[model samples]
Target: MDEAALREMLDAVRSGAMTSDDAVAVLRRLPFADLGFARVDHHRALRLGMAETVYAPGKTPEQCAAIVAELLAQPGSSPVILSRADDEQAAAALAANPGGARTRATVVWRPAAERAERVVVVTAGTADQPVADECACTLAAHGFRPVRISDVGVAGLHRILDAVEELATADAVVVVAGMEGALASVVGGLTAAPVVAVPTSVGYGASLAGVTALLSMLASCASGITVVGIDNGFGAACAVVRLLPSAVTTRV
Candidate 1:
């Protein structure tokens, strides 16, 4: 349960509106819920300042739908994010719960409450848009406003240069790229905000399925750049949220 729900429960008990036994019944399934195939963490928002997310790569559409349904049934569950979801999986999830919104490879169930902070998502090229969109969708699910900057790879240095002012205003930045991953370093140099780099598998043979880009990001000369695994847009978004100053107060 979220802090608001917990406080309401306690207040009800204190004011004689609810019995201690009644409160216990309400909190019986808290902390987590087991759904046969998956154990959904119901208290992640309380513990980590963010809710649990569903990664939909290996699971079938039915499995993903079942997990999302369980999460939605909780009393104070935060918005659920389904990352790396294919078209069929997205369709299934949306069919199960019409409240969710879908991008290319990500689905988000954002709550009505909105976050004040904004994050900038910069992609190296058009090919990186999928990963960048995933990062943006994930950030939105976590309550951050994501501003997308597309096709700003190092090859076209002027493109990112033009976005420097805009990027600097964000609470954090997520740079998505492949092929050497120099965009992260460039973005790092331009913005004072924390940079979370995501290397995608968007390059040719020498890229080694983004290993080259991953290594380049890892060895970045930029002062304060961090890197996630290849095509891990969700993880990069989470890192950006963690880096925000108000994340503790804006618990997802």
Candidate 2:
């Protein structure tokens, strides 16, 4: 339960609108509700700024559905995000909730879409789209409308420069690149917005399975770019979300 829901329950009990026993029944599940296989953390949103996210990498479809359902059942101002979902996981999460849609790793509430801020997701090539999509979708879940600029590898500087208008208006940017990871540095040089560098495993042998890209991003010449792990789109999304404007919200 969130603050508003908790307050409503308290008000009902104190005003005799709800019986003490009924109030107890409602609040008894405040912290969590056991589902045999999983214990859903209903109180996470109260402690953190958002609800507990679903990590669908290793979880079964049923478990992901149950966890997503439990999180949705809680009242909160922010939308929910599920990260690292493969195709099957994405399908399962969508099947679990009628309120959400298949968007990369998770589904989000439709009303929350209006609050989606502006962000730019720059990708080096088509190979990076999956990781780029993960970042974009995760940002959308956290209320950000991501502008995608794909196949703009540093090999052709003009391609990236062409999208300067969209890049300039963004509150933040996520750069997903695989090879030398030079796109993040170049984008960081062009924009004042926070740049989240995501290195993907899309390069050849010398790329060392994304390790080269990861190290390149970590050692970027750009002054203020932030580097997440190889293919860690979720981390980049969360970092951008934290920088979002703070508005007081009523939670249930």
Candidate 3:
């Protein structure tokens, strides 16, 4: 449960509108819910100002659906996210939990509140869009407004240069790139905002299937840039969330 629900419960008890025993019954599954296959983290939103997400890679389709259902059962505004689901897994999970807005590699279960903070997600090329889509989904699900600037790779210096206003105005930036991943360095140099870089497995042999890009981003000449694993858009989005101030309310 979120802080609002907890406070409301306590207020009900104080006014004699609800019994202490009934309140205890409602909170019995807090901290986590043991679902045998997985222990759903019901208290994460209360602690982190963000909720837990279900990673759907190794788990069974049924397990993923069940976990999603359990998370949806909580009383909070943060959306329930299921990431990296294949066709079968997405079908199954979306079937059991029918309302998530689906995107490439990710699905979001609730309509997040629109906040004022702006996060710019920039991709090196058209090929990097799938990774950028994943990052956008996570950012929107967590209530951060994601501004997408697409196919602005450094190969055409004029393209990324054209987006200077969009880049410079953001509260945080996520750069998804492949090949030498020079885009991250370019973006890092362009914006004063905190930048998080993602190396995608989108290049040929010499790119080392993203390792070359990963290393290039890690050793970027631009100082204070953060690099995440290859094609890990969800993690990149989470990093952006941590970098920005929390939009979720504390006393509401």
For each candidate, what is the lDDT? 0.84, 0.79, 0.89
lDDT of 2 by residue, 24-85 (tens): 77668778889898788778756655566778777988788788787777655556666676
Q: For every model shown, what is its TM-score relative to the native structure?
A: 0.92, 0.85, 0.94
> How many clashes (backbone atoms < 3 Å, residues ≥3 apart in a chain or on different chains) does model 1 have?
0
lDDT per residue (tens digit) for residues 73-157 in model 1: 7666367878788998889988998889878878778552667877889899999988888788777777777888999999989
Q: Which pairs of residues clash in candidate 1, taking residues 3 or more apart in a chain or in different chains?
A: none
lDDT of 3 by residue, 170-249 (tens): 99999999999999999999999999999999999999999999999999999999999999999999898777746444
Task: Please state the error at residue 27 of candidate 1 in Å.
Answer: 1.5
Per-candidate clash tally:
0, 2, 0
Instruction: Sort by TM-score, best first.
Output: 3, 1, 2
C-alpha positional error of residue 177 in candidate 1 after TM-score superposition, expressed in Å? 0.8
Question: Which pairs of residues clash in candidate 3, taking residues 3 or more apart in a chain or in different chains?
Answer: none
Candidate 2 yields a Cα-based lDDT of 0.79
Question: Could you arrange the candidates by lDDT from highest to lowest?
Answer: 3, 1, 2
- Highest-TM-score candidate: 3
2 or 3, greater by TM-score: 3
Model number with the top lDDT: 3
